[model samples]
Target: MSALLRAEGVGKAYTLRGKRVDILRDVDLAVRGGEVTALVGHSGSGKTTLLHILGLLTPPDSGRVFVADTDTSGLADGALADLRRTRLGFVFQSYNLLPQHSALRNVVLPYTGRGADGERHARALLDRVGLAERAHHLPSELSGGEQQRVALARALINDPPVVLADEPTGNLDTRSEETLLGLFRELADEGRAVLLVTHNPAVSEAADRVHRLDAGALVAEGSAA
Candidate 1:
């Protein structure tokens, strides 16, 4: 399969108290359709920075990023936002669900333009994540795992080709983590490219390939399975 996402020589830096702090440098990465690529690293190791760049949440100081054959280097803010909304999915560690919305409503938020079928699609995604019975529950009423599942369903509601997950199972129990990993595998099987940033070895084990980062650079790439 061809690459669904690609990043070449990407770099990001931030200024802290008049000092330059480099987050990532010369990073080259790619994710093909139907693959799960795990980025593993310790805290403060630029994993999240790399993920943010890959997801287009933050632009790199220098480098080229392409998603689904579109080069994003010179896109304006509005155009980039449109690309992100239409072609990408995100799952964060915090779940990030709206407290006021039910599980189904949270998933439907991404499909507002789909008219009447949004709710039905949301319900189906919830069922896929094993949360059909909890569809009406609010984020606060659900377990951490259930909340994460809702978030995952919301991420997929758009049916984007690429999913970027940042520490997605960081707060879940072992069993919950296992369930989420299974869902991720299913997504990959359906030809979605998954790039996940995780510190957990168990999570990395589920990936087909693992890339390790340290001190603002990719240090190792190997098979996790």
Candidate 2:
């Protein structure tokens, strides 16, 4: 099967002060359907940079990103946005929820416009995340784990083919982290490509494959513990 998401010889850099600092170099990776792939690295090791590139939120300085065999490099910004909407779901460490919106509204916001069906779908997702009772609550009223679960529901709102998470469990306690990880595993089991960037040892151990990022490249690969 083809990779749902792939990066070939990908490179990224930033102008830090007067010099160009390389964040990723010659990075090649792929996430296939029915599997969870974990990218592990220390802080500032380009894990997030690579995730952004894969998500098409950032352009790579070199190399290419492919979504199911289509090179994203040739797509225009609007086209990229459309592809991202239909093909990719993203979860962030910060729980990037709209504080003003209720949990159900936040999940429905990803769709074009609000409708009865959309609300029903969003509510089902909230229920899946064990937040059905809190669907009407605002982000501030939810605990950290609840907020992250809401974010996860939002990510799946579109039923995309791939899910990319950056430090998804960074803020949760052990139980919450386990809950999120199980959801990720379920996503993979259902044939979605799940790629997550995490420094947490337990998260890495739960994946099907673990790739370590170091010195701007993929330094190692092994089966999960």
Candidate 3:
């Protein structure tokens, strides 16, 4: 099978203080269906930058990004937005939930205005993440772990082919981290590509492949074992 996501010679740079700062350089990466790929790196190592590029949230300076067999390099802004909304899921460390919205609403927001089964699908996802009971609770009323689980539910509501998580369990306790990791593994097993950026060793161990980024380059790639 073809890779669910692929990046070749990807490069990203920014200008700071009148100097060019390269965040990623000549990075070649691929995530096939039914695999969890962990990206491990310290702060400022460009893990988030790479994730954004992969997710189509940011365009790379020089590279080719293919998602589900479509090359995104030539897609217009509107086309890219449409592709991202329908084909990709994202989990972030911050949760990014609206404080006033209930967990169910938060999860369904992605499907809103799109005439999709926003509520029904969102509820099913919440059940999958073990958050069915807390579906009516607001973000502030839930614990960090609960919020993250809700985020996970929200991410899956679109039934995307790939999920990108950035520090997904960064603020959760050990048990919560384990729960999230389990969900990730399950997603991969179901043939969805799961790419996670994290510093947690436990997260790395759960992945089918782990990659290390240093100085804006991919320096290592290996299996958890």
Candidate 4:
């Protein structure tokens, strides 16, 4: 199968004080279906920035991002939003769950226009993520692991082909990190393109492929299984 997500010659820069700092430069990435690709880099190395560009959350200063072979550079804001809603799923370092909503409600929020069956689908996703029992619990009422599981379930609710996560396990303990990593692997096995930005060695060990970002470029690490 072809890559579900691609970035070619992508570059970004920001003005810090009087200097123009380059975050990424001529970076090329290909996230294929049925694989978990881990991006490892130090702080301020632009891992999350690249993830945002791949997810269409931020536009790169140069180069192109392709989702399912469709170049996103020319898409209008509305079109980009539509693609993000229908083609991609994102998970952040923080759970980013609504404080006032139940886990089930949070999962269903993305499926708002799907009518009444949305709840059923959300419940099934909760079950898939091993959070069925916590469906009605608030974020405050759940453990960090449980809250992250809820976020994972919510990301999968749309069944998007590409899943982008940035430092998703940053706040989790070792066991919780392992649990989430397992889910990510499972998603890859099921043919979703899973890309996550993480500094953890365990996270890279669990992936099908590892890419290290340094000085605004990506270098493949290790061989694929």
| TM-score of each prediction | 0.97, 0.96, 0.96, 0.96
Rank by lDDT, descending?
2, 3, 1, 4
Local distance difference test values of all predictions, in order: 0.91, 0.92, 0.92, 0.90
Evaluated against the true structure, the overall lDDT of model 4 is 0.90
Off by over 4 Å in 4: none
RMSD of 1: 1.0
Write candidate 1's Cα lDDT for 102-122 as tens digits: 999999987836577888889
Model 2: which ten-residue window has the lowest total lDDT? 111-120
* Model 4, span 58-87: residue lDDT tens: 999999999997999989999999889888
Question: Model 3, stretches more than 4 Å misplaced?
Answer: 112-116
Q: Could you tell me how far off, in angstroms, the CA of residue 79 lies in candidate 4 after the best superposition? A: 0.7
RMSD of 3: 1.4
Angstrom error at residue 187, model 3: 0.4
Backbone clashes, each candidate: 0, 0, 0, 0
Q: How high is the lDDT of residue 196 in model 3?
A: 96
